[model samples]
Target chain A: MSTTARRSRLHRQEHLTALAFVALPVIGFLLFTLYPMLFSVYASFTNWNGLTAPVFSGFDNYIAMVQDPYFLESMYNTFFLMLGIPIGLVISLALALAMNRKMRGSTFFRTIYYVPVISSIAAVAILWQWAFNGDFGLINQILALVGIDGPNWLQDTATVKPALIIMAIWKGLGFSMLLYLAALQSVPRHLYEAAALDGAGAWKQFRHITVPMVRPVTFFLVVTSVIGGSQVFVEINIMTPTGGPEFSSATIVWYIWQKAFDNLQMGYASAMSIVLGLMVFLITFIQFRLNRRNQFSID
Target chain B: MSSQRVLPSPPPLKPERNLPDRTSSRAASHTKTRTRPSNSERKHRLGNLIVTIVLSLGAVVMVAPLLWTFSTSLKTREGVFALPPQWIPDPFVWENYLRIWSAGPLLTGIQNSLIVACTVTIVGTLFSALAAFAFAKMRMPFKNVVFLSLLAALMVPFPTLMIPQFTMFASIGWVDTLLPLIVPFIFGNIIMIFFLRQYLNSVPDSIIEAARIDGASFLQIFFRLIFPIIKPAIAAQFILWFMAVWNDYLAPIIYLNSPEVQTLQLVIANFNAQYAIQTDYPLIMAASFVALLPVLIVFIVFQRQIIESIALTGSKG
Candidate 1:
């Protein structure tokens, strides 16, 4: 009876010790993330100037959000930027395939491609800002060599989104290619040989074996790219200081940030943030369902 | 051989030197290529040559802009707009390097960034490892429940929380200071905790149990046994985390108003904003390159580890 009681006491001690080990992070989650999330939900209905108490304004912020032209424009521009996702994926996959082929100096190419990915976004944006200068730009200067005069990229709304998309593809290519290369490595070579023996050509083999095999990585990339694309701010901040002529380059996060800090419209910004959160949640959920269906059919 | 039956996971754990062994064997196969007259072998050789040429061209596209950035930093401010733009600056003005120190709070920004990133990463990593250990190994009440809840917090998105968080910090008067950036992070990063937990789960429970039987306390075991075993994982996560904090702009801009309190990226961004209009392109380029240099150096030194860690994250996820 005494030994049993001692054993129970020792177990309690272990439990408490483990809890102590985890206390800081658990408490931190509460104080930082959970508290702010709860506050955000409450603050969404108020008209807070951030200096004074948030006075509850009900659905006014939500109602105003729908009619806000800046919000709408920023929302449209954000999604438009995501057009780079498919472009980046296709380019990365092709690059991965090329690198996967029997080759020398593959590591050299891998490092070269990943350089842009590792560079700071702010720095890259600043460099690109100069590169997009109408007259003296690197891009236009190169285009001049080909007898083509490139249009001013960032100043005009028409070309601004495309310019951002091209930059995004260039920056993201190496990382995605690396992921795809790793995935390609794991695919059984015998499957390719089997397909070849069955008279399947290179394109047919790629379509049948390679594409399906890399689907998980594709899904991973797509989900992350969308999450990242939704929060695009630094480039827009650096390259197009006023949000690209007509707010053409402003993303949703950039809009929310401007509203909250610049204008001190914390409540209205909170409402928009809640909407963005839901949009992210909904999009991720839908993608998850789509992925499940794809997996089911493949199985 | 890649033909060996693949491990069910950790696919790219294949050594980076996987190619060198094959190259070493090429001396034996030297005769085969020399004697090769077959159409298939010829096609294969041609394909490799074509790929090499194309990838080299791609590499040029990848590197030219960075090279341009470095070159631009050395040009005269007026030379930046010079027609038939100089790929290599004519005079190679070495003055921007000296001028950039006075251009903004570049030195202060570097110091602030170093303090915040170094403290947060060094301390936060320890706390995260501790949390990961507790969740992965120890028997605690509501363990998975607590772990899952912390994971859920990650989904809230910072924009949704930045307002309330800002208010909370402002009430404490942490605005215009580095505390807002450092404090929340030092509590522990959920992503780091998650990855470390995934790493720890691979460790055999038997060894830990054996240690426990020897009467070593949990903290003792963690310090002597766990930390070293997971040192590689910790280092990978540390370097990535440090780079992230250094490159971060959005959070620092939101909190730090004064130039002195701002982080490195923010200071360079301010230079870009303030000086680009003044047509001080060389100074701005110089400052920007300085901000990028630290991470760029880290990447070059730990290139293999960083790439593998990233590749591991993708497959493991």
Candidate 2:
């Protein structure tokens, strides 16, 4: 064979091998995920009780969601959970900064914080349920020490979401901390040194050097936390069986679950699911746009 | 991904070399005459000490709930809810651990969880790997469209499909069986497939060319060459899928109706509510802790591999 022919044959063979590697995942995604997603969009328009065949009912479920008190309550509850994202990001960054120093037992601290990340949400929920139990719980005991009586946390309308938020922070902080720690480590020492040489104080150095360097990481965490926060189901499902007092803690996913499972409102549930997906996607899209703007300024 | 953020090493400061300033002569003279720590050094030392103490205390706070769960499981019923919530369960009720064996339907639930998790992990990894390989290497037309579509799959939000999937499974009369839990594993998971595909794309094209020159088929190249190289990626996906399926509650709740098909999550959720008459709080907590053992074991065993893979993958993600 000519040299050119030999090289071309080898190149073709490599391309063929590449082709083989990507085949199965493509087919699977088409069959499972994409198909189901498309299926969901179509299903949202139909009146189906999961058992019966889906019937065409144009815009009814969507129209119903506009007026549905339960859906509105769930939306409110979802935004309530989202409040934790900013608080969580700041607290996690603070924790990460504290740990980033060459302190003794740093690994021990990282591992300690990360324990909750791996823990089952069900386990965390049950544990929190006990801790937030109205009468004999630990939070109440602590409250009593401070000369304040605590309400039935999970059952009280005012306290339920806050209690869940506290648990969410406790459950969530470790993962965010790990992400921040990674971001913090990536920051160059020269930047800090340059700031120090310029007579910048520690706070100023952190504000100018550390924060800008880790902006991408911060953006990533905030976006993801919002996504995860909106789908807050297992925590509520386990901790507050009735979805908290007066349905205050029933977030979007949890509400959809109740509709589909308890009320057998499959059509309505599917519509709610679409709305939730759009909300998450929109938030993420906004975040990415905002991230690009931040990156542009930083660069 | 965090590991990639290596800071540039600053030049080491020598006391004499960098002390060319007017302030240094006075500072040097003051320090040279004294063995006692200066106020600034004392403050620095104090600051360091404070940070160390605070960080460690934060660690304790972070881990306290886990410790609480563990220690409380060892306590007697009275001790479990004691007013001052005993940090130390003196004369620990060893029966709490022992009674878990006698706990109702726990053994069955454990078996069910293990079967589902194992099946999900093994099958999910295989399917995902196969799909990932196809996406990474196969030369089909319209590949990017398919790949982008697959990426889009990650955003569908899982709950959106739960009702429909349940309905679909119910139509096939698979809802009550382990089929709903296991069948999807055969189809493949989007997240795992994406992870594998990304890692496989990083594998150099030259190795596959070498295999193909010897007249190896696509399947052979995949099984022998591609698979071996991506073991780290596979192990990473394995741990993730294992944890996910093991901890999954929503699916099992929706699909598995019978006691025979119940997952560990469902069992734990219903442990106090269902088996309340038979076992008390300590026993329930003990069983709960026992249920957590497999996850802990998996975490400890693959913790290093998982963490490194996450660090690597998180950068690209």
DockQ of every candidate structure: 0.64, 0.45
Which residue window of length 10 is worst by lDDT in model 2 chain B?
A: B1-10
lDDT of 2 by residue, A198-250 (tens): 99999999899888977877777787788888888888887777877788988
User: Per-candidate RMSD vs. true structure?
Assistant: 4.6, 7.3
lDDT of 1 by residue, B91-140 (tens): 98898999999879999999999999999999999999998999999899
First chain of candidate 1, TM-score: 0.97
Number of clashes in every candidate structure?
Answer: 0, 18
Model 1 chain A, poorest ten-residue lDDT window? A181-190
Write candidate 2's Cα lDDT for B1-317 as tens digits: 11112211222211112112325543754575366568766765576688888877777777766666677788887776676657778668888787776666678888988898888788768777877877777665576777788777777788877877787788778977887888766667778777777777666666656665566777777776767667766887788778888888888888877877788888887875554344366676676777777887877677766555554443445
Docking class of 2: acceptable
Which parts of model 2 have CA positions greater than 4 angstroms off? A1-21, B1-45, B275-279
